[model samples]
Target: MAFIQIIEGRTSRFDEMQALTEEFRERSEGASTVRRGIETRDRDDPNRFMVLVFFDSYESAMENSNRPETDEFSQKMMELVDGPPTFHNLDVLKDETS
Candidate 1:
């Protein structure tokens, strides 16, 4: 089962945030535990963004969080966000395709 983390926040510096997000991917790509990631912005409010990161497991996600690179990335993220981000932790119970 994949462990997922959803992060949503408002960022006035949307362009800067996009660049930082790419940097985050580059830094973390070595960690095979990170399965996938996606980012989206609200059409009504471009500054409002949401990012979903998928991990192989909750443990792996925790390990990623402990990395110094992740800490640096997080700090940069906080600086760009207008306010604190909201996180939703999820255990994927099922993923089905027809």
Candidate 2:
């Protein structure tokens, strides 16, 4: 089954984080197991952001942590964010295509 990894947190430096997010998008394009990703900010809390990453499977999603590009992004994100980012892994129950 497919899986999704949700990473959410508050960033003191939104601009820097945004720049890193842009890089993440470009770098992740080549991740063989990644299907897609969605990045969003809370409307009520602009500083809080969430990134939803979809992968082929749980193992694939976990592999992302070991990716050099992902590692680099993580390092920068940790520096710009407040405290540690929270990750929620979900099993994709129903994914439909039109």
TM-score of each: 0.93, 0.86
- The TM-score of candidate 2 is 0.86
Given candidate 2, what's the lDDT at residue 22? 88
| RMSD of each predicted structure | 1.2, 1.8
Q: In candidate 2, what are the lDDT values of residues 1-98, reduced to their tens digit?
A: 89999999998788888888888877778674678878899999999999898988998877877888888888888999988989999999998899
Name the runs in model 1 displaced over 4 angstroms. Answer: none
| Model 2 lDDT, residue 71, Cα | 80
**Candidate 2: clashing residue pairs, number:** 0
- Give each model's whole-structure lDDT: 0.90, 0.86
lDDT value, residue 82 of candidate 1: 94
Give the top-scoring candidate (TM-score).
1
lDDT measured at residue 2 in model 1 versus the true structure, 0 to 100: 80
| Most accurate candidate by lDDT | 1
